[model samples]
Target: MFQRPGKNEYLESQERYVSLVPAEGDLLTILKEQTAEMHSLLGGLTEEQGNYRYAPEKWSIKGVIGHLTDNDRIMSYRMLCFARGEQAPLPGYDENDYAAAGEFDRFTLKEMVEHYGIVRQSTLALMASFKEDAWTGRENSMTRK
Candidate 1:
């Protein structure tokens, strides 16, 4: 089981997100369980429900799922780069831009969730492939000018 990362292991800006993870637990198992939980929770929503937005400016349920899927892919890629000891400067991304580009409303929620499942499966596979030492490897040159 991978231990929770130290505060210093990630950027201060990411603390809010990092702290959401429980301090103790098998990370992989939690990830798998979370996937099932998401599927259970979102699987029942109708396509119309998925298209609903709280406000005109807010993303629909489908957009939210698409954004999460995109975030997962990006985060997993960063992890992969870290595990491989890559030193290239990693650029940041704007979630708003991604969400706008996705045009998530065109697809059904089931399609979006299924795509998420595929991405999560790949993420699980990548995490499982990492050696013990790879967990400690990180790209420290991510700072931007």
Candidate 2:
């Protein structure tokens, strides 16, 4: 079941984004519903459309989707570390670098969406295995300049 995270549960820098999360339902419930909604939203884009960028130097649609996948992986890893009570500081990743290296424009939009779905399923499973203590787990906040 979802318990809204307390003010101290996450770092202040992330408050804006974390605050956007739904506070009324379990994590899995939100994940499941959002995943379905995301799939529906992006499912119709074709490879040609995915390659379209709104402006020069901007990320293509596929690149944007790929970055979302990368974010999911990175955040999930952080959650796993916190859940397992890992005391070591976790380093951050550059989403732009990951997106560039992913070469998402090489694939069809369908492939990118499919990849997200699979990763999300794995995330759901990992989250489902958490114990109550794990659910409430916290980690030391490490900041980078």
Candidate 3:
């Protein structure tokens, strides 16, 4: 059986788990800045670098970017669920499985980066529109709990 965390446990866990929960006044700005940074880091890679894996069995840079895109989408969905007060436990994903299936080694770094930028922009727009109440809301996300 699953048990809800006690108040102290919840608070303690939240301190370590929540990511990018902006201050009351700077939510939009923070989201914009973060999105821009993601764009900048992802935009400077070349095709060879994207396909180059650090290890034979590890993900290529393009795969890493794809994984980040997937994570952003998942977090956006979780935020939406939290904002609407959903109690259903969201499912977790296998990162390695997803990365393996992505076959990002075939794509050029420039293409992957462009795709990441578009996804990040959409995520930023969604986050920027959330009201204060929504931004501060909590949910039992797989990533956080």
Candidate number with greatest lDDT? 1
lDDT of 3: 0.68
Clashing pairs in 1: none
Looking at model 1, which ten-residue stretch has the lowest summed lDDT? 136-145
Task: State the local distance difference test value for candidate 2.
Answer: 0.81
**Clashing residue pair totals per candidate (backbone < 3 A):** 0, 0, 0
> How does model 3 score by TM-score?
0.73
RMSD of 2: 2.3
Question: Which portions of model 3 show Cα errors greater than 4 Å?
Answer: 1-25, 138-145
Local accuracy of candidate 1 as per-residue lDDT tens digits, 57-110: 999999999999999999898888777877777778999999999999999888
Q: How many angstroms is residue 140 displaced in model 3 relative to the true structure, after the best TM-score fit?
A: 7.6
Off by over 4 Å in 1: 138-145
Q: What is the lDDT of residue 17 in candidate 1?
A: 81
Alpha-carbon RMSD, each predicted model: 2.0, 2.3, 6.0
Over the full model, what C-alpha lDDT does candidate 1 score relative to the true structure?
A: 0.86
Candidates' lDDT values, in order? 0.86, 0.81, 0.68
Instruction: List candidate 2 segments past 4 Å from native.
Output: 138-145
TM-score for candidate 1: 0.93
Clashing pairs in 3: none
So what's the TM-score on candidate 2? Answer: 0.90
For residue 60, model 2's alpha carbon misses the true position, in angstroms, by 1.2
